[model samples]
Target: MQFKNRPNECVTTTDGREVWLSRSVATAVCILLECEGRPYILVNQRGPGMPDFAGYWNLPCGYLDYDETTAEAAMREVWEECGVNTLELLAQATCEFFSAPWDVNSTPRGARQNVTIHHGLFARVAQLPPVSNANNEPDETTDIRWLPLSDVETLTFAFNHHERIADFLAHVEKLAGISYR
Candidate 1:
């Protein structure tokens, strides 16, 4: 049986006929918030003591627990990692798909199994966090900031998040009917 497009699911177009769905193993979220009349993306930096990509920045991300839905996990993670509690899902937006395999030698968890799934989701907040993300968890995140999308290209990101951000921006223009300057 072939997969059918679910309503509001994300699809991409290429060369008129070529199209595909985005997928990833775990969910990562992009929360678009604005300040001073400019759009910004919320990102968190890893703590220096972490095993992987320590000191690198990334979107609010986490693996889905056994009982939690993607959106639930996303909300929980955002609250856990960031101090903001006002974000709600832009559930109508298509989920940007991502695919990749865990390193076999480095991690026996997946045994090199590649996993694909949608993000926690593209969510939104009414405004920037007044006090901002304060990592109260165990040394997971060191800092959080709202940075202008225009300056995104200049920063260092972990896990190819830079490419992910670019993909999100493009999709916002194409599917969301909003253009980023």
Candidate 2:
């Protein structure tokens, strides 16, 4: 059966059966760093006037462009939102996928019916790099920070990022053969 007035949302298969389109794919980057022998992760505050979760903190993330791989999209989002070049930094990174469904009435702009694929790009660093937009123009992020893992529980995270952060930390703990608690 064809969906009425929603041609883009449905497609006919070779067997002539109509199927709903798959969910959109987005990428979320978890840039892990080590500072002063402690672990930190990159996060950014959504700028004011954002369609969803404005003023709340989130990982450097965006939708995957049609011409790029998920890894490339993650790296691009990192540079765009945090001004950090991840091409060299992500040599040792790992990736994970997660499914995120928006509330019926709470879908954000550009992310309706999308599923986020979380990418964890962990790196060891001695110092934090300064973050600024390459074009010196305002964008989606208002603040960028390298937050200590121990302090992550105290902040409000957007897009279910708190769970994503926890998962990353758990993975780190498993790799390091240690547990936080």
Put down candidate 1 lDDT per residue, 98-159, tens digits, no spaces. 22211111222333222423343333445566424454467888888887888888778987
lDDT to native, each model: 0.60, 0.70
Instruction: Please write out the lDDT profile of model 2 over residues 27-131, one tens digit for every residue.
Output: 887777776778788898888757789899999888788898777777788888889877656553432221221112223355376666666655566676677
- Which regions of candidate 1 fall more than 4 Å away from where they truly are? 1-24, 86-116, 120-126, 131-136
Give, for candidate 1, the lowest lDDT window spanning 10 residues.
99-108
Q: After superposition, how far is residue 100 of candidate 1 from its true place, in Å?
A: 20
Top of the candidates by lDDT:
2
Scored by TM-score, the top model is 2
Q: To one decimal, what is the Cα RMSD in angstroms of model 2 from the true structure?
A: 7.5
RMSD of each: 13.2, 7.5
TM-score of 1: 0.65
